[model samples]
Target: MTTTPPPPQVVGPAGAGARTGSGDVAATLRATKKRLTSPWATFAAVVLAVLWTIPTFGLLVTSFRPAADINATGWWTVLTSPNFTLENYQTVMAVDSSQSLLPFIINSVVITIPSVVLPIFLATLAAYSFAWMQFRGRDALFVAVFALQVVPIQVTLIPLLSLYADIGVAGTFWAVWISHTMFGLPLAVFLLHNFMREIPGELIEAARVDGAGHVTVFFRLMLPLLKPALAAFGIYQFLWVWNDLLVALTFAGSSNQVAPMTVALFNLTGTRGSQWFLLSAGAFVSIIVPALVFLSLQRYFVRGLLAGSVKG
Candidate 1:
């Protein structure tokens, strides 16, 4: 119209801002839901978890069932009969020399403790040197060490066994201990070095400014912050050493005195393999320690994983 029309009413800033905020919130919620429950992704995750858990669950069920029941039908059939017994575990824990797992359990403890401790302790020192100390060819040395991860354990086994034999340490706990230490060092140092680099340079500089030496800085400053990483790596090395068969077999052999639980468990399956109950119970018995270690350190492991995501 030719006549001046009323000026168009303006929307208030607050109203527009609120509307935008709501839209943003809705979009964020949608994205979160999409990530959490994409149809195919959800299905795949469920399927994978089920596939992984079924075997472990079956093993646990089989461990408690009577030998007759286990041989008569599959572990799944236990649901119908509801039979349970502790005799399998009793046999596994018996004091008899042939069937007793006590000595092997003790051996695993002995082997695993040193294997875990020595590597972590040595790795910490090496990692600190690499991450902080100035030296010629430090980077080259670190790269070379990291590259050692590519070497297969099998490839080194013959030479390592020979070397152990030459040193007269073969067929003893020392062989497994030192072998694990050497094999575990490179990866351990790499992981610890990377983690050490993630510490704030400012804090380190401040410590240096306050008259703290490298040793002081490492023990007083770095080690405290590295607890999560240490716990994570400890769990990893524990599981690896505990579950290891090839290394134990190669070094410790069938000698019940030095062989770990894994070797003992392997011995259970002889020519006939008739002792299904013993095998099941023995398997669960061997699993208990690692499971406990994981459960006890799970928090640290998760924290370590998240902290590792941060860049240096």
Candidate 2:
């Protein structure tokens, strides 16, 4: 009766509970941060980074060293002796020589672009279907496709080659293109499907409710969200196809016109193995494009790899 009993004292556990919860959260976050930045963790990371970088550093040093110097001493000797030259690169890239890698470089680009594009394009469609579409035997079919990744490419080479021959496309760019597409599809589908499944079902349902068809949803909604995943897979496929020796040798070895840089580098070893400088230079040449590609898309690569790792 006296001033409404001072608003009923207005006392409860609500404010105390919130403060306690926030304190716990902050304590947990601080512990996590401290653990991540601990000295042992930093040391381990540094050691691993150095171990991985040494060989590539050696390769770079060897690539620039003169042929005589390369054969006589290790790449590390460059720190004291300090000798370098561009002759190795010159010899490998010289147009007048039969060892010229120019044509093979061009061939690699041709083979790689289509090989990367075809699988990604097809796999995106397949992944979308596997993830969102409700059809009979869908799960069984997805498992079957996933199982193909375990099948060795070596085992399939002969049969695939025979099929290509029967179709009269063997030893042609078409054969290599198709072979790479087939070989790349299984992993591509698996990866993209996992990523697609991570996306909220409500978004797809909302689009459908608004009269957007599969094609519209895929192009307009899914594609933008899928950029990181696509770039990650694209980099992986690009590197694999670019550095591939066995596949190129098997499918495109019949002619220089179709063979990629790996095939050319292989021939360099067979024919000019004694020339250490040429091998080093060719190795660097083969790696440059892939390195650049990886660097350019590295942000996307990391994001793509983290897809489906956590849910909120």
Candidate 3:
């Protein structure tokens, strides 16, 4: 052209929005790096890590020690003697003894799976209804559910167990599953509802404009976005149910087929308890799955917590 075209005018809103987004990302990255590199933060993290690892390391070493050595000496002595055996693991895993923990471990798996899944599934639906649907009393209902969290599980156990007994489901896995689901629901719904409300309304509107029904939108859009929240709650429920001894004792303790590993491990600590090695081995056995799960999903858990804390 004879004259250079007038310099193009830059759009304001789009560029501003992009710059804002990048600024937020950069801020977050800088914050993370600062926290990681700070001497005090690094020292605190290492100290806490060492504190946690010591007990676990001791338990693992004790598990490997011979029964005689475990009874006679502290686990720290292993560094000097270094005498280890797998007999404890073999003894605890054996099926012949009435005290063998294998069957109870299986029962734990059975109880934990349903207890975690049912609450999350039901809670997601309830949370969606509360978050997005137009329904009278939605806020009130959510508050009521949130309020239930203050009520102790101890208060509910007696009545709940009695109801289970009347219904003839007492001492069965059903009782434990139902109890865990009920106890978990209030908190689950409260948490998931909060997370659901964080989702961009424009996305939901666009989905609706495309003729997607509630169910379709939930499955295709919300579910994928909700994975972090779900994983966070899933991990919490898994650890709670897996480690719970009181609930299991009340409902399923009488039935060997339904009792969990906690019940079996508790049995090892009672009168005539001489199986320190077995207890140590059993502790690690029960711990392995939960540790693996936490390691695998920890990223999602942390992200969910951060997202929940911040409003987009």
lDDT of 2 at 174: 94
Better of 1 and 3 by TM-score: 1
TM-scores for all candidates: the values are 0.81, 0.78, 0.80
The lDDT, on a scale of 0 to 1, for candidate 3 is 0.85
Candidate 1: tens digits of C-alpha lDDT, residues 78-117: 7777899998898878888466787888899999999999
**lDDT tens readout by residue for model 2, 29-92:** 6766787899899999999999999999898889999988899999998888899899889987
Better of 1 and 3 by lDDT: 3
List clashing residue pairs in candidate 3: none
Q: What lDDT score belongs to each candidate, Candidate 1 first?
A: 0.84, 0.84, 0.85
Which candidate wins on TM-score? 1
User: Between candidates 2 and 3, which one is better according to lDDT?
Assistant: 3
True-structure RMSD for candidate 2: 9.4
| Global CA lDDT computed for model 1 | 0.84
Q: Which 10-residue window in model 3 sums to the lowest lDDT?
A: 303-312
